[model samples]
Target: MRVLSRVGCHLCEEALPVVDRVCAERGESYDVADIDADPVLVARYSDLVPVVFVDGVEFATWRVDPAALDAALRRPR
Candidate 1:
């Protein structure tokens, strides 16, 4: 999974704990890359931090509800 987040973004902060818990509980591996780290990503996701990509595909963005995230994760990868 790819999580596009900023260093101090509130949305990203909110999503982190949830994602961390899910990953730990499900034994899933995920990568959290900062949106501002890559120039291309900084441009693409400047206004949309906290974007989520699952299995190399975008699964969710902006607002991520835990329940929805859980459901998305539960689906066969």
Candidate 2:
């Protein structure tokens, strides 16, 4: 899983813990990318910080849904 975020973004801050907790519970690994750090990411998701991706596919946006994330993590790849 991955979270695309930006500095000073409250939504991103809020989503991180949910993602982290879900991933930890499932023993899944995740990465966080600051959209501002990558030009391409900024272009694709600047307006959608806090975006979550599982296996390189978008899973959630804006707010992180714990139940949904748990389901996604439990899904077979």
Kindly list the per-residue Cα lDDT of model 2 for residues 1-77, writing each as its tens digit: 78899999999999999998988899999988888988999888988889999999998899989998999888899
* lDDT against the true structure, each candidate: 0.84, 0.91
lDDT of 1 by residue, 1-77 (tens): 77989998998988888888887877887899987879999988899879988888787777777777778888996
User: What are the RMSD figures for all models against the true structure?
Assistant: 1.2, 0.7
The regions of model 2 sitting more than 4 angstroms off are: none
Q: Which predicted model would earn the best lDDT?
A: 2
lDDT of 2 at 30: 90
Candidate 2 weakest lDDT stretch, 10 residues: 41-50
Clashing pairs in 1: none
